[model samples]
Target: MSRWRTALVTGASSGIGREIARQAAARGVDVVAVARREDELRTLAREVRDTWGRTVEVLPADLLTAGGLAAVEARLADPDRPVDLLVNNAGFGSLGWFHELPIDREDRQIRLNVLAVTRLASAALAAMVPRGRGGVLNVSSVSGFQPMPTNAVYGASKAFVTSLSQALHEEVRGAGVHVTALCPGFTRTEFQAVAGSDVRSLPPWVWMTSAAVARAGLDAVTRNRAVCVPGAGYRAVATVVDLAPRDVVRRLTALATRASLPAPEAGR
Candidate 1:
């Protein structure tokens, strides 16, 4: 059983975030599911309630705006509705050369992927530390461990998440709070479609389900583990990237990423 009682999950409408919410509710935790899609969030809340018999409150807001982000911060900062688990799972990527893609698009990606993660994590920790119990899970990617040529900005954002999560994990270990970065490789999600990449082009062996990734993240954070790359293959790959020659890793990553990856579709 998880020590957490209530959780606030960004991007809880679908994919890995939704899975995490379900898993948390299964362990008897109340959930506040945040996402831009109001309908999807409502549906998920209903499913969680019906399936796990746990309460799920849906909050629809875009983290890109100051108002939307502020509302979430206030909720986390509120002592009355204290959230013991925080999952920063809301993020998207653009697949293209850094210079070729619209600079504004990359900036939005950073704002949501990096800035939002930083601010929300801060809010969660500020409250969690005082209470002396809580956990923060930041959903990152395997690309954080290596350079991704086609998706440079997205990779950079994940790197920030991975680095920050590891540092924060150590910083708050004695404070009775856990911070974990969940670095998952390719999974069966709408992420690829939205990013304008075809999932079928990638090797089947590299794919894992969102449910599997969510389970790994929840387990790791509960155990106070700092970093978790879910799949066996990806774990081995991450280990090699950390130990291997930087030049070799760079060349290999660029080559692999470029082969299966296409530039993001126009206006995507």
Candidate 2:
């Protein structure tokens, strides 16, 4: 059984967010599913209700907008309908040289990944700290562990998430609230297509299923772990990155990332 009675999961229309919602419901927790895609959210709601007999609330809202953010924040803060868990999983990324990517998109990425997560977490903690019970699971990425040359903004955003989660974990541990950062590496999700990341060159073993990542994250948060790196290979990479000198890690990451990209098309 889940420690939470109700969970509010962002980015719930697909991928890791969708899996988290399904798994949480299966574990006996009601869910509030948030995403920009209403149709997909409704579909997931039907599936969850049918399979697990759990109440699934489909909340279609773009986190990038103020109104959407307010709606979700209000739900988390509702005294009568309290949320026992907050899954900050709604985010996206872009893969390209920092200068080449559209500035507007990068700004939106930071807003969703960093600003939205921060706002939601703050709202959840405000409620949970008073009640002395609850959990916040922030979905981050292994890219945050090192300098991602082609994926700089996304990496920085996740680093903020991981840092914030760890700090909050210590802050609320005594108050009975658990805060955890779920840092996943290369996972099989719509993320690749959306980010324009061509991972065809990577070995099969490097990718993880969304189900496995979701399961690991849920279990870790329930156990009050400050950080959870889902796969053993990723854990090894994170460990090495942590111990390695900053310059060495940055140089190696740049080289590896550049090698993965196709050569630039004929110059303008």
TM-score of each: 0.96, 0.97
TM-score, cand. 1 vs. native = 0.96
Tell me the alpha-carbon RMSD of every candidate.
2.7, 1.5
> Of the candidates shown, which would achieve the greatest lDDT relative to the real structure?
2
Q: Please, what are the lDDT tens digits per residue for candidate 2 over residues 1-268?
A: 6799999999999999999999999999999999999999999999999999999998899999999999999999999999999999999999887777899999999999999999999999999999999999999999888878889999999999999999999999789999999999989989999998778889999999999999999999999999999999899999999999999999999888888776555452
Cα deviation at 148, candidate 1, in Å, is 0.9
> Tens digits of per-residue lDDT for model 1 on 1-268?
6789999999998899999999999999999999999999999888988888999988898999999999999999999999999999999998876768889989999999999999999999999999999999999999899778988999999999999999999999799999999999988888988787766656678789999999999999999889999989889989999999999999998787767655555654
What would you estimate as the lDDT of candidate 2? 0.95
Which regions of candidate 2 are displaced past 4 Å? 263-268
